[model samples]
Target: MASSHPRVLAIVLAGGEGKRLMPLTAQRAKPAVPFGGIYRLVDFALSNIINSHYLHVIVLTQYKSHSLDRHISKTWRMSALLGNYVSSVPAQQRVGKHWYLGSADAIHQSLNIIEDERPDIVVVVGADHVYRMDFSQMVDAHIESGARATVSAIRQPIALADQFGVIDVDPQDPTRIREFLEKPVNPVGLPDSPTEVLASMGNYVFDADALVEAVTKDAANPDSRHDMGGDIIPAFVDEGTAGVYDMIRNEVPGATDRDRYYWRDVGTIDAYFDANKDLIAVQPVFNLYNEDWPLYTGYTGLPPAKFVHAGPGRLGHAADSIVSPGVLVSGATVAGSILSPGVHLHSWATLTDSVVMDGVQVHRHAQVHRAILDKNVVVDERARIGVDHEEDRARGFTVTDSGITVVPKGSHVA
Candidate 1:
């Protein structure tokens, strides 16, 4: 028996050209960037939408979207009998001979989808963030509040408010948004909690009719930047119809106090590296083993990860790490790291506090620490990375100020 549900549509913005995550995004779109060894960044957004029972989704993609398109097509197939699908819509230049000018422009160009689906509500989200959210709850809140639009907000420390788009709710009406601040040097705290500011998580729910009208109007505005956060959201806030959904109220089935509300914007290399390392923690900030709200991804049918002993009391060992399927660790030591599928750590190799992507190989006696190795990277025997910043830089590798070395895809470290 089918239960009654609203006609909802989800739009995932996957077109971001992650300039900060260079080398990694040089080939694939930002959403196509791998995370936690097994899943891409887009997987988090799509999985949340699916878990919330929103079956109709449209992933809007642009710059280097081939892998993103392929991943979505292969991994997100829904039942045809139920009229469910997860489609990837490229920059078709339907309105004009131009790619997506901005987030608002993407929606403006894709208004035909809204007309076709005729959904009552539209759930829009960014594809590059890592979080588990129930958009249905936000939708319900939007309907009840009689607001035209609702944006999900995560509470962040007052000190870090400048890094995000801050949302200030109305003093009288706590749920209504009074202002939308973009990376403000000094942001006012929430009405309830003065120590924290509500930052936009780049997730929104809007009435279908209101959204279509807003985007259409934005497209015609010559002065508008055609952005969701900067233009569309500010317009809504000025209209007094934009409400805020505090994420602290969103409760997941298997959430814990420590891991709950774990939303990370892994846009920059350092942030990306930190988030990946968060998984290998003794008590991870984000729990991937939550069967109640599972993170879905494409399966490669690879064999289980294998570890071999080197004999004579030497052993292949790993601690506080996520070793993906098809990984082979023979006489190697891995600690505080993530090894993607098909990675090979040869004898006498040692890796610490690093991320090794798919098909990467660490040759004998190689040492890697506090580094990110892109797909198929080969570290030659006795090659040391993250040991000397000057050497890493001299070899054309990217070394961040925070002391994290990033090797580009398929590169050889000697």
Candidate 2:
């Protein structure tokens, strides 16, 4: 039985130093990094929470959080008249002089927010994933199951189980979590499906009392990692109060079958690039045009994208790409790419299978292939990036093992 509109407080964890996505994470927090032409990674989490009508939300930030804080403050303003707010709470060393040790410790330090809000249930989610979920339904499942903590789980291949924290479900009770294993070398498959396992999505709903208690206990343990996945959740599993909410059952209003269960943890350069590419598909794996549940962000009031120079050998064309507002593809050929707001591609420049972020300038005759250019990057005339691995490395640009070149923010490539 679902509780009739229980007081819910959502806490978005946005503090991780994304070491894998360097240069992009060089100046900004991972969640604050630009995504999908127009939005930040944290926007997805905040959008879902607000779309689900969970109005009272606080974003927890640490570790180079200035950009993240600015984005949240400017983009996520809710009406104060309705007593609803979407605010970013930075780590203030409330417990002591130390910064946040881990995710659990971050929350433990900011328990004052929870206490002040006095919410019945807390919705804790990560800020670096691309997905849409009806968390209200998860909250209902949490209340109905009578679990102290409920983890949102998605089915992943057993072979790739070592990459994620796998959840072992009780054979007798599908909702009950039998064990929580963090990236185990040899993982157990699901009870019904031997080839698939329930992988934790790092999103959780906790009974307010249970959450506070678990974090408090973990803080006292000397050997604890002070992590929600490593310490707090395991304690709930031991108490038999940890439940699993299958993400497959989550139904959004305008979601299609193709993108119904689409969730991507864009943790690495390759994964992040792939996730953005997923949006530009003919039939996108993750549809962003769903008007029923719109992805909210701070919109720059700019005019529509413009294309010019239709003469021979100077066609300003963008095929199979997402071109955001204020982008001018002047005599350039953009294919299989994303041109973010205010990007200007000059004559004869070719951008293919790449992501060029806001305010970037790809000068005349420059070519960018299979690369990610961060904000305000200036590619000088005829400059070549992502073409030669040796040259890219020699230029001090970060090149991935998969050969994706990453040009950092505000860089001028000559």
TM-score of each predicted structure versus truth: 0.96, 0.98
For model 1, how does the per-residue alpha-carbon lDDT over 48-103 read when each residue is reduced to its tens digit? 99999899999999989999999999999777789889999999999999999998
State each candidate's clash count.
Answer: 0, 0
RMSD of 2: 1.3
Q: Ten residues in a row with the worst lDDT in model 1?
A: 1-10
- Candidate 1 collision pairs: none
Overall lDDT per candidate, in order of appearance? 0.91, 0.93
Best by TM-score: 2
Which stretches of candidate 2 lie above 4 Å from their native place?
A: 1-3, 191-193
For model 2, how does the per-residue alpha-carbon lDDT over 1-414 read when each residue is reduced to its tens digit? 225779999999999999888989998999998999999999999999999999999999998999899888888978899989999989998998999999999999989999999889999999999999999999999999999999999998898788778998888998999999988898877768989888999999998988988998888988998998888888899999999999988999999889999998888999999999999887899999999999999899999999998677888999999999999999999999988999999999999999999999999999899999999999999999999989999999999989999999999999
Global lDDT of model 2: 0.93
Deviation in angstroms for 328 in model 1?
0.3
RMSD of each: 2.2, 1.3
